[model samples]
Target chain A: MPEIILIDDPADPRVAAYRDVRERDLVGREGLFVAEGEVVLNVLARSTLCEPASLMIARKRVAGLADLIARLPEDVPVYSASQEAMDAVVGFHIHRGILALGRRRAPASAADMLAGLGEGALVLALSGIANHDNMGGLFRNAAAFGVDAVLLDTDCCDPLYRKAIRVSVGAVLVTPFATAQGDLLEVLTAAGFETVALSPGGATRLVDLKRPSKAAVLLGAEGPGLAASVLARATTVAIPMATGFDSLNVATTGGIVLHHLAFAALRD
Target chain B: MPEIILIDDPADPRVAAYRDVRERDLVGREGLFVAEGEVVLNVLARSTLCEPASLMIARKRVAGLADLIARLPEDVPVYSASQEAMDAVVGFHIHRGILALGRRRAPASAADMLAGLGEGALVLALSGIANHDNMGGLFRNAAAFGVDAVLLDTDCCDPLYRKAIRVSVGAVLVTPFATAQGDLLEVLTAAGFETVALSPGGATRLVDLKRPSKAAVLLGAEGPGLAASVLARATTVAIPMATGFDSLNVATTGGIVLHHLAFAALRD
Candidate 1:
């Protein structure tokens, strides 16, 4: 069982990491990120890839989370504080009354993650998905569709940000993702994966494409879609849309394409 | 041409409807709602179902929006204010430099909207979707996939809410939508539509369902899914998901299911 520490002071050195979370998020959280709410905390406890550094809970909610608290590693400290004190420490009203600080393991290289997947793997590759909400939604969709892994280009936002984690409903904690800097298409191609780039201008419609044994769908950010050079290298497919309508949000687009791949695999 | 009026004072009674928007959103906007940003303003201008009462724009952005401004009805007033003045009036920075007060037409009944769609119509029916962002996203997805119309149970949030309109990229302005107090499924069934209710414990996996000539997908808000009674009245369909995973966001689910129906219709 984890040690239960009592916290009375908002400025306690032990809980210093939890201070002004939103401002810290903007500057970067170094190697650590905060996960909020009971649902996310439960997910954090279950994740094998992420290590929880500590946990903070409202005093009133401790009894409800006893089982979850007991599951933490012996060395991990669990702290309980009055809701007022906890709110002051976090610099926000954490209405859900639970939070955990988690550290990510060293990220796998995109090449390494792709190499580990089986021959029939389904992957989601994203480019320039700078919006944190979109990034979180993509991770949530990837997990729902049973995507093997997600690959992000250098420009993609950090999925571990608190808002992203909350938006994902903790899916980012479970979904394995990696970032690569250059020539993501070349890396994907070299892995023997059939790459399909989603674009408004495409050679084929999404529904018409034959399901491949190993497939990766490439998605770009919302407004400025995939670069022309990137589309040139892959089999370009468009989600058939109403004439003169704006394209679907990038996360929604990813969900549809991933759904197609997932159910297509089930049929095979 | 819209009469361009220069307003120097922030507290001008002419623009009284535009004050403290966030606070006003909580109480209500009477029959009026604000549409912000260039894209949404253009969409609001083109909407035949909604009428714009007035427009408030940053003076600097006037020249760029000349074509859009000219398209507005002659009776509609266009008020241009300096940036600082506009900010003081709206109680927030109007960074997009465009705002329009639009009034919804007296809503059509669910039965009425359903009666108007053709025999091969595709519709989205929603229940208890109170979140503004989800409401907006549903509209955006509906428009992207060419859904003929949207039907909402009385429990759903207002799609005309400012945040919903913004998140939808203005899709809500153009898509025809209606709300009914009870038994929305019955209305669809009476209209000769096959209604499919989305739930995690659905009887049919989404990909396996054959396309119907006229289909309406019923989606519930996340967390508490469709009520058992509601699902009992329609064909319950589940998105085949990975085991132990929560379901997709309601909007994303709508996107995938609608994508299926849209593509299926094309093939037929």
Candidate 2:
């Protein structure tokens, strides 16, 4: 069983990872990635591939969760803070009383991500989506729709940011993503992938495309949309949209596209 | 033409309407709302109903835009803050460079919302969605689909909250919405509206709805979903789906439904 120690002090160094998250934003390289709430924390604890380093809970709610709490290594820090201290340490009032902190693992390289695709995997290639919540929602949509991976072409926000993780409702950690694509189309195409760009003004509707051996979707930033150069490379596939909706958020658009492709491909 | 004045001090009361927005969550009673970026600000200034109460611009970037800067009223507060003081006032980073404080107007009531419902009005009824971003996006999607109004059920988050306003890209101000619903079914039935409860396990597909004269979608909170009593009171609509997908965010799901309804209602 993981050791669950009582913590009365907000300043306790033993719970250091759980404190000072906002202050860490000023540090060049020390921002904390926190997952809070029972639903999210439980998901993090179960993601053995990227285990949380420590767990903290409200003192009163720890009784019946003994079995779930035992899954972590005993040496892994587990602190039971009063709800007040839990709120104080987290920078804002997070109602999700339980929080788990994890050291971010190095993200997979874009090249390595392309190499990992199975025969007909679908990947989301984002361009200029700066909002963390939108990125998280995209990942949540991707995971729910069964995309193999998500790749960020330069200028997307960090997927591991606290707000992104929260907006994703814990989907970010479960959905595999990689950043840094040098000439994104070149990279995916070199990896034997055909690129499909989702746009309202495109030449073809989404249903027209049969499954490809491997597919990558190029999505642009929210307003000005995909760069002309970026769209030039991908096959233009528009979602059969309702009139006047010349836009969809990068993530939701990615979701609809992924859903259609997943169904067309007959993938689980 | 609007007047522009530069103020070096953070203490200047002229910019007060736009100050401390992230921290001051309640500005609704004051009848002022903030819109960031040139795009949303421009849109607000152009709209007859919305008016900019103040304008803030970066010192260096103020040179080229004589026309946009000139469009404001002379007495309207236009305080050009140094980038440093600008950051201090807004309570977060100001990457957008320009910000506008606009006058808020009373929303059209649910009855008034129905009175304006032409053949193509798509409305969103908030059940328990309390997240600010979700609330904003729901409103934004409503506007994108030309939704007539969003009716806030009791207990939904305020659309005017800074986070919701910011996240919706200021679509909250553009969309017509009001808060209050005695009974979800009763309101829709009285207004000649079809109330569709959007749930993952719902049996009716959106495409099968046959495009009613006027329709309103009932959406729920993120985690717990629609309360059973509320769902029990709805028409129970579903989006077309593939097998493994769980559900889209309440707003996105609403967006998909609105899009299809609009597509069917209007040929363009």
Candidates' RMSD to native: 1.6, 4.3
| Fnat of each candidate | 0.87, 0.17
How many clashes in each structure? 0, 2
lDDT of 1 by residue, A1-268 (tens): 9989999899898999899988999998879999999988988999977889999999999999999998999999999988998999999898988988999877788889999987779889999998889998999999898888999899998999998998888889988889977877998888888898999988988877777788989999878899999999899999889875756989999999988887664325
The candidate maximizing TM-score is 1
lDDT of 1 at B35: 94
Clashing pairs in 1: none
Cα shift from native, residue B245, model 1 (Å)? 1.5
Interface RMSD of each: 0.9, 3.5
Per-residue error for A96 in candidate 2, Å, reads 3.4
lDDT of 2 by residue, B197-237 (tens): 88766767665666666777788786687777777767787
